[model samples]
Target: MPEGITAECLMENIMEKISDNLPKQKNASFFEDDKSNSMSTQFNRLFGRQKPVHHLLGGGKSADVLLWRDKKISASCLTGATVVWVLFEWLNYNFLTLLSLAIAIGMVAQFAWKTASGMLNRSPSEVPHLVLPEHVFINIGKLVGVEVNRGLNFLQDVACGGNVKQLLGVVLSLWAVAIIGSWCNLLTVVYIGFVAAHTLPVLYERYENEVDGFVSNALDQFQHNYRKLDARVLSRIPTGKFRGKKFE
Candidate 1:
């Protein structure tokens, strides 16, 4: 070969090798980026919570009580609940009867205190008046009203939203509640749930990792089964017009 032509051919061969290597490097980086992105895509934690359990519970005095940060207050709450359950369930006390009895006793005690203080020639200022601030009741009523409205709106939305999964979930939840209510009365169920609310969060917070891992595994398995079920059965269900987009 002539020297000039040989040099040109060699340069072309080198350029071709460089071009081929550049694409391979780019493709490798592209795949690496894709793999990293896939790895970074995290499934949701339990209940889809992105915050710590304390923050999710509002990170306030209420959360403190629920998580038993103040053991005394938490104990007092459980004790009070126990007392109420005992009163209604074991002692068979009607709420109206208890309320009336409590009011009557309070009135008698207040009257007796005033009479005794007067007979003792105690100063009028010595009599302490038991008074409730009106705003306390107003605030409580507002809170209750807001919660009631919210619950009603949620029920209405779930009823009319036409989401099968959501509807089934609500139905199953309500059905479970009904079964529990049948086992005991409403008060028993409420008390049990209140107790669980006080205890479960603390336990979950203590072992969040294990619980999360277990829940994640269970959810994955459930999703796997659900996909199979959807493909085999739910997908076969005739939707006709309802198969289209929900809102649009």
Candidate 2:
């Protein structure tokens, strides 16, 4: 509108103004603050309002202080021994009878201790606590709920064209697990898993570099084989435009 200002000059001025207002670089601190707040909020939503309980009986530090110690090794050993015992007893063992015997022994021991304490006029020892606190169960429930929600969200994402290949691979892996699980008893699977959980982590930690190298080599070999297979077979298949796009 001014006498010396042409349309080009006006456009240039507007572009410069826009460029001046644009951020030159991302603020790392701002993003870090946001991420911390988000994680804190999620943590609070899961466990903040729950009542504190004794740490020895399924509370905070229970896993690290109790289960992660020599007790884990002892439990693993007991599990292995039990499996061996069952195999040896193949047809003659009765789990119910064994359980009843254990209960009877425990009851008798408790009763004897109480009688002795009463005769001596001494205080009776408190019973060993095994029950988990309500808060621990609540936290577990919340974790399961979150995982279920995440799985549903993943399904929705897959349905909406969000990486079909990766999703299909995950589904196939789960299906394979289910097929294998069909041949295994739940308790056996759990016992093996429990033992592995305790043993594998310590092994890996003790041999971190060696484990990393082994894993890296194995992954490389797998990828190489997968690529060769893909080229030999999958490449012949015609994926539509949407199906062929690379997912981030």
Candidate 3:
């Protein structure tokens, strides 16, 4: 909230507050503590852990829970999208057209690398240590696994009511169409490249926005969580010892 403070700083402050009262035996880096893990851990633990913020806000304003929820949604959405794009490219790869397929693979790799670099550069304070598997095939398989699980979850939830398998099949079909169409005519290939290239910026922008929104939501969640913890700490004391005292 400070005037000059960057979004990264705000996010760190938020996460620090949220994780402050919890056990830290794992020594896991903060960036790795994603919402998918945190939410799965259960918010109810905030009470058993004697999280003070809960007691403070009980009778007052209702916590604006939307921020954290939205943050998770946004992060999942963008991550899911990138994974899907990469997968679609691979699913349609044709070794018969070696040159085009090679170019496509290179482009996908470049985009993924660029995305990773952009994320790290945006928040230099948040160091993301990417773990590369021992073998290239294993690494690729891991990425595909992420896409399969995470992407499916996103589709089932975000694009609700669609048959996931059918949807994936359709995407694969389109990939084939694009490739085949490209081989049929130079104009088709140029058109495909032009369309996809023009749309790339939009996708990138959407991805960046989702990441930023995720950070913002995380900060808000930390603040709300802290407020609950502060409240709990105050209740244990005698009324006379500290009257209407605000926890800093």
135-190: candidate 3 lDDT, tens digit per residue: 99888999999889886675444334334444555678779988898666544354
Question: After best superposition, candidate 1 residue 144: deviation in angstroms?
Answer: 3.8
Local error of candidate 2 at 159, Å? 4.7
Q: List residue ranges in candidate 2 displaced over 4 A.
A: 1-108, 116-132, 159-164, 235-248
Model 1 CA deviation exceeding 4 Å by range = 1-44, 118-121, 124-131, 240-248
Cα lDDT, all candidates? 0.86, 0.66, 0.54
Best by TM-score: 1
**Candidate number that wins on lDDT, 2 or 3:** 2
Better of 1 and 2 by TM-score: 1
Poorest lDDT segment (10 consecutive residues) of candidate 3 = 59-68
Instruction: Give lDDT tens digits, candidate 1, residues 26-104.
Output: 9999999998765543344676666788999999999999999999999999999999999999999999999999999
Arrange candidates, best TM-score first: 1, 2, 3
lDDT of 2: 0.66
Worst 10 residues of 2 by lDDT: 45-54
Residue 160 in candidate 1 has what lDDT? 74
Q: Runs in model 3 with CA error above 4 Å?
A: 1-134, 159-195, 198-248
